[model samples]
Target chain A: MTNPIVLDVNNLAVSFQTFEGDVKAVRGVSFQLKKGETLAIVGESGSGKSVSTKAINRLLPVKNTLIESGEILFEGKDLLQLSEKDMQKVRGNDIAMIFQDPMTSLNPTMKVGKQIAEPLIAHIGLSKEKAKARAIELMDLVGIRNPNEAYKRYPHQFSGGMRQRVMIAIALACEPKILIADEPTTALDVTIQAQILDLMNKLKKELDTSIIFITHDLGVVAQMADRVAVMYAGQIVEVGTADEIFYNPMHPYTWGLLASMPTLEVGKKQLYTIPGSPPNLLHPVKGDAFAPRNDYALGIDFVEEPDLFQVTETHYAKTWLLHPDAPSVIPPEEVRRRKEKYQTVRMGKACGERIGGGAIGSGG
Target chain B: MKKYIAKRLLTAIPVLLMISIAAFIMINLAPGDPTNLYVMPDATPEQMEATRRALGLDQSYPVQYMRWLTRALRGDLGISYSTRYPVLPILVSRIGPTVALMGTTLLVSYIIAIPLGIISARKQGTWVDTLLTGGAFIGVSIPNFFLGLGLIYIFAVQLKWFPTGGMLELGGNASILSVLHHLVLPVAVLSTFYIANMTRYVRSTMIDVYGENYIRTATAKGLTKQVILTRHGIRNALIPIITIIGTDLPRLVGGAIVTEQIFQWPGLGRLTILAINQREYPMLMAITLLSAVVVLLVNLLVDMMYAVVDPRIKYD
Candidate 1:
């Protein structure tokens, strides 16, 4: 039997108060995160993926950010209804967040071990001695060498990869059930990014923690996610298992994302880019947000937003092409060939064959 | 760090020497002579010339500077024209009262302004913030001398709650209560600018620190608003403030001069004014050089503080 859902976000809508008007940053976004699952929320900047995740933790600025409508249900309790005092108990203890930019994420004035030990002492009421031991243990667990010596060192003393590892150790200190990483490796170099991602995946498996990974990088999403949710403007346009989203993506926006990613297989000099910018959320578009930028946009796509159309039990896409009366459309040829390549790689992995890292690099 | 401090102190030697020369030249070049303050108007020209020659003021600027520099290097700052006591001894005796008064003022200003600034930043845009910010503007705008007179009028004149001025009563011994009694007005006057400046600084720096990513991380770690503030907010905001306070130490000497004059406080500032007015060349030179040395030492101390507050800053 499939693992039960651990978090259910229903019809979430969020807006930010601005001088111009209220910007509808996240509108009618809904998703489920299963226990021990890695769900990657992929989108370009300002797509509201990060906003939606922050809304779950109520981390948005109290002054201008408003949740117009939403219910973030975690373990049968509506987190939105909980008081900030109660939310404090849930945060770091039940759900911890790893932010982008590790350089700025760790306190410059504080020692790294004390930073990691902070949550432990706060949530578990651990004694200072115990917390220190636990902090050192966490540092070791996150792959930092010589935990005893490094514990007293400040963030600036460590390399980028080591600093990110420190961030992960801090997040995992209280042993939360859910980990939310918001583009955790986007600021690191390519090699460091791979190492960080690998470390996170290993930790996730060992801890059995449900992770909601937010990133704009398809390469990261391809390597780290069990399920993928493609966000456009302020809405989720497509969500399915990683294989289904990679092999049989139905939404035109998802097709664009897949096409735009630079892959080794695509030897052509010209790289594909999405034609136009995301819709301005201040005016609140009447139809689908991606319609203006979509080349395969149908007549009705300009006038109305489509509901999620389920192709399989787990795969759902919101697109006009999924309508019964709409003409059939196909993804670009590049997507089709890449999908075939991923399939072969997957089959080889399933057969326990070491096909090497070249296939995985091309898949990205 | 020690090497950096050594280098700083080494550079200060030339700066102090130049200040001593400038102080000597400016006083000598000015229309006043030290003999005028001491010699009687009815004294004969022979007596005036004898006094000038004895004091070595009749010498050229270079010869006077060399004599003063030699005496200073030997720790003998010559006799004060007004007091007829050794300038070094007089300055040494005055240091205690000035340090105590200014030290208390700075301590009180920091104690009050830090919390007020933090509250202003945390409650930014609220009435509390508005009120505190308004107070800071007024504090910064008001002249210290005017503020000193106003405070004396209210507390000393109207309330009769404290002594009017000076370090202690004329005949009273150095008791804590009497010192505190005298301290109230001068400290209040001296600290007004520091409080205003420090509060505004703390508010601005705290606001900037509140937006930092580490603050968010601290919040996400389930830290209460208070913990997040003390652990992350204040520590980061304190860096720039260290620079402010560190640099402000040298400025305190200038402030003390004005404050000391108004209160009749027996401190270096009052002595400085007395020396300038009386044209006590040796005393004035000593005070100027002493101030320059203090400025260099305090700045070096501040740089060291920067390294302490932020481990990322390495002097090496």
Candidate 2:
């Protein structure tokens, strides 16, 4: 049987009121998180990947933040319409979040064990003693050795990687149905990033928890994502299965994202970069937001925004090049090379042999 | 912790020694002589010389300082040049009143300021915040002596609701109620400045703390606003607030100098002024040393409090 959908976000729009004007941070974004699967939203900075997920849990700042339009559906209830009092019941209990910066995410003054126990005591009405017992168990589950000894220590006593594990322990303390991790490993070193990613992958299977992993790291996306959604300028430009997005990316933006990944080649002169900065969100855009940056921009791309065109039963892309009437443009040679390399790695994995390189490193 | 305290105390010795040397040199260099207070203007130079010899001012600076230091180390601060009694006892008697006044003012100001600061920070940019911020500016700007006189004139002279000055009613029985009656005006004047200062400090510190990532984490944990504020906001804000409180400890004596002068309160501040005017070098030296020691100990206490409040700050 197919896994059920746990979270359905429809047409979500979020904005921030600043001195200049309203900043449309997230403009009409939508995605689904299926139960027991990992959905990775990949983008560059300011692509609104983080904002869309934070809006799901209602974790955006109260002041100056306006959710202009959206519906976050969880368990047949529109979370947007729920009062803050009811929303509290959902946060950290039904849905938990782990932030990017581990050093600052956990309260420095409070003990790590107490922090993990906070949600248990708040939502489940567990007694202090019972919560402490459960918290120690969670610490052990997150691979914290000597959980009893580490319980009394503060966040400052732990290293960056250890603090992130503590954050994960806190997020998973209440057995949340959906865990939104906002770049959870971006701040960690490469080796530590792999370990945290591995821990998350292992825990997701053990607990059967759905996850919305937001990051700009494609290597991490390759390792952790079951489904991938490529966001550009606060909109999902392309989305498909992990294999489809990495091996057969359709949108020019997705092509740039994959081509930008540093390959293990002997004499590649420089990495390909998408030219031009992202469009400023202070003012509304009349047509396609990425037209100026796209080298394959058609005349209509600058005058009219393209809707998502169906490429396959499971894949969709928002680019005019996929139109039947449009001329077929060839993707760059680097894009073709990456797909071939990834296919070879996949074949190696099937034969019980491991291949290590960029973009497809440590495939889960 | 014990080792930290001992190290702090050891370091304070050199600081105290430096302050003492500076005070002795400055006092001796001033344009006045102790013998001038004793002898008549028409007296012969030999009579003045004899008075200086008896007071040991005839000796060199080092000899005089060494003699005073030796006696001071023995807990004998010498007889006051003005009062003719021992300096330490007079100081001891005055300590009770100053402590009572300062302690009450600190308690009252914190009681008023903490809530006001939290409210001002919570309701930032609202009318309540604007009003408190404006009032704090005025309170901080207005001199304490002026505020004290204004309070005495309004509440004491015209309104006649509370006693004008002193720690108790004149020739009346020394009861708690009577002392409280007299404490009203001085406490009001002194605490106004403290409340204004602390309210602004707590407001800004709390505003910064509210923006910390931990607060967002607290919110994500589904904590109510009240719990988030008390548990996460205030506790983190308290680290900087404690620092300001420690720095303000020296202001107890500094603020009291002018406040006590206006209120005619029987405190060391008034005694200090009297000693300075009459050139009671022995009494002045004793009070200065006491203040220096108090300041050093207060700094040490503040350091200890840092360890208690923030786990990141481990003394050991």
Candidate 3:
């Protein structure tokens, strides 16, 4: 049997030495991704989603960061142990990342074609003419119309969606095994977000590239994730297939997230909201990090921490409620109402798959 | 671009106008007249009054200003009260040494500071960074006179490598080579401050640019670290560096009085001092006005460089 895991991140913990004190950013966060899977890490700001990915790239400054413990074994090599010189080779060859703000991530003075060709020259050793030709091909693959003309244009000359396409083109330049997209569509308009999502889905299926998508929008998680890992206070609180998380959430934080998602509930007077803020990781709790924000906290939640309890073969939850002796609790009524909305999503995907089963083979 | 130039030039007018007014008022407002400067100490009051009338100081303040402004526009800085030579030629002759010395020093300092600053920001808190930053602090804290004396002690007094004072020996014909020898100490004195301060600015700007996401993206794209620095960081850093040089050029071009005094370089600073001691108001006003104009022109040059660094900038 083939080994199922493509990335094995075991007990990874990270901290930052700030002026006030040492802020423990990521506390023993762990997860795994299989080949050709999309694992969406959903969290509020400072949940360590970005930091964990940056650690994978080894991009955090050494002066401030301390990766206290853990291992990130990609293809069985510890990424943290590699020197910066070696890391440069891994960055574009094995793992590549695309940032949220496309405008700031692209060098304002460089041509779009040249930016895309940079990785090809670095990793693939392509000459100027060959790189240019391949850059045009990548642009065409990303669905930029008239790719030949687009090659001569600079970044500022492109529209917002088009700029992101250039960024996507640059990330896909070397065709790495894994792609990390951090809020790729957060800055885009509503309509553009859908198109970019579709593009990413199509690209992932075509390239067979395992993507770790970092986002806070649950709707995006539903649309794009093969599996969802809900993160809070730098730890994974829930992990399951997208169907499991949206249709049948097992964690209180996951319930809160589902309830607060703004959608087409037209006549509702007020949108549901999660009561308290995400825990401040600078000074985290002794027991459960989400307990203060969670309303259904049991007595044990204040004194002892929760561990990941298996819900199904593919699902897990880190909550005291999952214990055999604990009182049974249900996700709030609003989450039950939201379940009907996701039923429509499953129907739409099922219809899409039945209409063109062969088309699903190539996402385009 | 036209809007930017027009706005900048319009702002500069009032500044130059104020400089002219201040130079005008202060030169005439000083105690004692140029009359006593030309006369012997034993001269009678009538003789002093007569000398003052001959030089047109007896005219009304408004009249003195008009006559002064007219000759100033024509480039006739009045004759120096001390040497009785045309102030313009004395200034003109000395311009070569001052420009050469200040120009060479500023150029060399930038050449050293930019690369050093980029390296420092790249290495950031390493031993080399610590040592350079500490050295820059020492360069900034030590007084110009002391630094000058120390350098003279090293190269002149101790090693006997360069001349102690003057651009060339007193009787020797000035050549480019002879001129270079005299430039070493005074230029070194003046540049110690510019280099020290600019490196701090360069370091800060480099750090800021390096922190920008585009730089991280550049590294990820597999551009070598040096390419990331010189190609990306330095071009962005140039805006602030150029601004400093432009804003500070007047002081450099005119030459600092203290630094000029130490080395006895025949630059604008020494001429201003000589004019002041003899109370030559017209010559003083002219030199001050010229310095202000040169500074304004340099400001314009710096504005032009901004668009070159980041072409996204546009003026409506």
Which model is ahead, 1 or 3, in terms of lDDT? 1
Instruction: For candidate 2, write residues B1-316 as lDDT tens digits.
Output: 9998999999988898889899999999988898899999898999999999988899999999999999988989888876689998998989888888888898899999999999999988889999999999898899998888888888889999987788877686689988888888899988999999999999999899988999888888887788888888999998999998998786565438888888888998898999988999998898888888888888889989988899999888
- How big is the positional error of residue B236 in model 2, measured in Å on the Cα after superposition? 1.9
Name the better of 1 and 2 by TM-score: 2
Of the true interface contacts, each candidate retains a share of 0.71, 0.62, 0.48
Q: lDDT tens string, model 3, B1-316? A: 7887888889988897789878888877788677876889999989988988888889898888778767876877687766778877777776776777778888888888878777777778899889878878887898998888888889998999998888778787688888888887887887787787778778888899888888888876656776777677787678778888886677766877777877888887787787788887767876787798888888777768776766665556
lDDT of 3 by residue, A1-364 (tens): 1427778898999999988888888999889988899999999999999998888888888899999999999988999998878888888777888889987888776678888888898889999999999999999999899999989877788988998898899889999889999999999997888899999999999998999999998777767888889999989999987777877688999998877766555246576777878766777668898888888899888888898999878899999999999898766876675455556565775564321211012222
lDDT of each: 0.88, 0.88, 0.82
| Model 3, global lDDT | 0.82
First chain TM-score for all predictions: 0.94, 0.94, 0.91
Per-prediction TM-score, please? 0.94, 0.95, 0.90
Higher-scoring candidate on lDDT, 1 or 2: 2
For all predictions, the C-alpha RMSD in Å is 2.8, 2.7, 4.0
Backbone N/Cα/C clashes per model: 0, 0, 0
What stretches of model 1 exceed 4 Å from their correct place? A338-364, B1-4, B28-31, B40-50, B251-255
As for candidate 2, its clashing pairs are none
